[model samples]
Target chain A: MYDHKTRILYVEDSLADINLFKEFIDDKVELTVVSDGQSAKSYLHRLKQTKSHFPNLIILDINLPEISGFELLNLIKKEQRLKFIPTVMFSSSDNQRDIKDAFSQAANGYVVKPGDLGDYSRAIETFMNYWVYTCKLPQEQ
Target chain B: MLSKVSTFKTVLENLSDGISIIDKEGKHVWINKAMATITGFTKEELLKSSPPHIYWPEEELDTIMKALGETMEGKFRNFELIFVRKSGVRFPVLVNPSPIENDEGEVQYFVATVKDLTEVRRVQHELDDLAYNYRVLHDNTSELICRHELDGRYKSVSPSSIRITGYRPDELIGRDPYEFIKEDHLEQVRQNLHEQALAGNDLIRTQYEAKRKDGTIIWLDTITKTLLDENQKPTELVTISREITELKSLQTKLEENNRELKRSNMELENFAYIASHDLKEPLRTIDNYVQLFEMRYSHVLDDKARQYFEFIKSSAKHSIQLTEDLLNYSRLNSSEFPYKEVDMNEVLENVCSQLQSRIAKSQAKLVYDKNMPSLVGSHILLSRLFINLIANSIKFKSEEKPLIRIAVKETINAWQFSVSDNGVGIPKKSRKEVFEIFRRLRTTDDEKGSGMGLTICKRIVEKHQGEIWIEANEPKGSTFKFTISKHLKESTNV
Candidate 1:
């Protein structure tokens, strides 16, 4: 039996947050990290221009330095080629307004960043277990 | 008989009033002794004079001639004139002249009497001066002063009525006072006036809306009183009204500003909640990476290097806790929590079980009321309050085993609860400081706390319209007392 690794594009501003994500998933999945929304948008635009394969999932932070995560989400959803990719809003805010706005914009999921290290690791693990193993996704072109 | 006649003449001479008789041709025919004495002329000097033409002043000569002509026709009774004395001094006098007719009723001589009026004229002048002063004050004042008959008709109104009601004093007089009252306020005004009339001289103050002559409505604060007659019966109503339109509008504006301030404060609190929540993410990330580093490099790292990692991890964790506490505090302003009746016994049981490990380690004994009263509040927040207080008792334990006793009692309007602990009691001086956010009395490393537990408890209690305080427990312990109102109402913005 052969298994393929899942590819995820994680957009976050803080380096420590990026390190935290890398530590949790280890080598189980192929993770690509960008520090801001502008980099993530440019990278996606380059892949589309080159006809490269899209990632299996996109994790976005709501507060970003340039071109907020909301604006980037709208950009991705507006594009027919990239709209099929599942996007999850991973933010520190459990605010009702933020959650409502995310769901109203067709986000697949919203996860609050847990404060405890063990809880944070467990949350990411559960998310990976379901999205990468249990759930089905459209095959990348 | 001769003696009797002499005595009557003496009486006539001694009279204070002067008496005189004038003929039909306006001549002084007969003058008594009193008349000569009053005019500063001798009796012989008055009889020889021509009469009023010589005795009266030139300004009044025409009036005296008119009186003599009327007297000849038997028309004059009593008339007044200004008489000139022998010294040419003028004084006021009352004159009475009547015709003395012959047998065929033809006019003959005229009998006349004169009386001095100096004292009477002096008092009359004083009364006129007082009336003039009163009129000036009444017209110049800003207040609308009015006198109304028992039937509500305006008897008199001051000139200030024009400035207040846009109606001239003459126009308002004799008009019904209720005519100026706004249509909706007519009935209330009538009722108030009627009640005040029956109150018998007691001044009643009230406010109502009235229409000006220009048809603009204004607020009027009026003080009304009833004037009584000699029989103590209500005869008229006197009212002094002042326009209060500006004051009324200002009051409404102040109320609107207060409501606006409260709404903005709530918005600011919501912003604080979101900001603190966002800040926690970075702190958590720092903590997670530090832990990962320690786990991966503990073997190759020196002791000092490992200790540095521990310090970083600890500081990051503490910062995360502070942010979480701030979020919790601000969340109390949210109106999403619905109030319900919570059973205290169940809440206390759950809190103890949650802290079972700590209690087991410290060997603490927990005592509580068998039948705890249920209170109306948010169950989640109430549970959090008890958990913080109970956990605090376990954390701040003494050398002896911790003895925690929870008691509940019924008060006049609320349920009073006391949680007593046989732990190290708080000092009296720092008792109030402990409730402040991030204020810790015990700074030692062993007794570690976020120092936000009591502040959160205070916010929760205040949200429910209750109060919390601390007291010294007997025999070396501390007691935490709090109250919960029995009635459950909607939460207010605090």
Candidate 2:
């Protein structure tokens, strides 16, 4: 039932929110969580240099120190090597304008952070089932 | 003598003026060919007649006899009188009478030259009428009609100058037009006048600030045209001007109000955005952490403790919902979405799919017409409207399965839509207040709503230049009806 767990990069600032996500993502994927946008950029740069350890999915939080989720999405879409990896915006905002902006900046999906723990677990399960287990990705070379 | 007489006859026949000779006894002795033609009579008929001849109209007999008596006394005078032709047509003639003397120095015959004045009088009457009409127009019109010299002096001014510029026509005439213009606009006005003179008949129009005679400034919109002479050279400039001070001030005031309104609207949108993001973030965190704490320590937490956690989590969640609903309501104050051709059926389908879980949980039966018309609107807003209405029905359902129906009616200028549900109907007292923000009729803890659904719906409908209201559905239900204008314009800054 387990070959290689699908690799994912989660960009967030709040430790509690990341822990909350970690509780739901348990044993489902090789998850790498970064605290801020600066660390996320450096991690992506290392993956590009090594030609390995490239995640299959990247989830970004909108409000972060130094840079925003939309800016990182823009940078990722512009890079030839990092462009193919699927990206999603996970935020506490349910603003329609923000959702529209995320999609316009080439984010694959926008998911709002649910307040209830049960609802958040269900949302994470559905996101993992569809983006990780179902969708196919380009071979990392 | 006979040869001299014949020579004189030839000269008189060629004269354009009618020549006639009358004797002292007021009888026609002889007349020239022109006289016969002018009177429209044969020479034989005129010569054979006496004082009261066939040419005399009976109405002028007294005047004619008085003039004839004066001519007989050698008091010669040129008098204009009416003469009748043989065909009974009367015309005006100028008679020049002179007494001819014999060798005994006595007056002999009255020789008169009659000149027809019909064409002259006709032209004089036409000129008189034209002058009268021109004077009436120049005096009565409200526009300041002025004729200016090539150098910008007023050659002539209409009587309306007194009303428009507080100056009489005599006061304005021969005055330089720049004298009335404000100093700041004087250069521009002079430049415009120069350009207009060079542009010929292109009809240059300009608006400028000018001082009235009472030392008050007014706005003048003047159209200047170059009046050309026969050789196409511009002889004078004619300007037709009217005061536009009131219109200018109104436009300025309206612009200022619009600017103020725009500033306040932007501030409101900024406030809503800040509240939605900053305020809701902490509330969401509180709810999530509270739930996580309960899940981790369920054994240690007794029933009372667990109920306390429930209250905290619920309050936080309600706060988050309230913030979200308030943001949505404020966002509708400004049109952030552009209108496009949206299919109503598709919008409803999307809305139903969004509320699939809620519908399944409540076992609600949803029905609607398949042939909904396409219209111009914001698709996202319209979908939210339907979703809110349907969710509201499910939230307030009675002791039976909920039944909701969406219907549309085509109006002359709009598409009227109604969403009806067999739910616990709102009482008559609360029906009108339901559309107000935060006006919740039910305070039940289980019903998780922000009470802004109908308010947002009403705002959305109004943004499309439409209206919304609530009506009691027959046999126990509530129906929310609204209209969307057929020709909705895109992006009005409501």
**Best TM-score goes to which candidate?**
2
* Candidate 2 chain B least-lDDT 10 residues: B193-202
lDDT of 2 at B330: 81
Model 2: per-residue lDDT, tens digit, A79-104?
A: 98888788999998877779989998
DockQ-based CAPRI category assigned to the predicted complex of candidate 2: medium
Q: Model 1 chain B, poorest ten-residue lDDT window?
A: B485-494
In order, candidate lDDTs are: 0.82, 0.87
lDDT of 2 at B148: 89
Q: Write the per-residue lDDT of candidate 2 for residues B250-355, one digit (tens) a residue.
A: 9899999999998998897779867776888778888888878877887898899888877887788789889878877887764467788899989999998999
Q: Residue B174 lDDT in model 2?
A: 88
True lDDT of residue B428, candidate 1: 92
Best of the candidates, DockQ? 2
Q: Looking at candidate 2, what is the lDDT of residue B339?
A: 84
Candidate 1 CAPRI assessment class = acceptable
lDDT of each residue in B1-494, candidate 1, tens digit only: 57986796677567788877766666677677779867888877777777455677888888887877777767878888888888999989998876778899887888777888877899998998889888887988888899988888889999998889999999999998788888888888777765766667367777889999999988998888888889999888888888899988998899999899988988888788878877877677677777777778889988998888778877887888788888888887776566877888888888888888888888999999879987778877888888888888877777789999999889888888888998889989877877898877674575566798998888888877778998998897789998888877644642
- Output the TM-score of candidate 1: 0.58
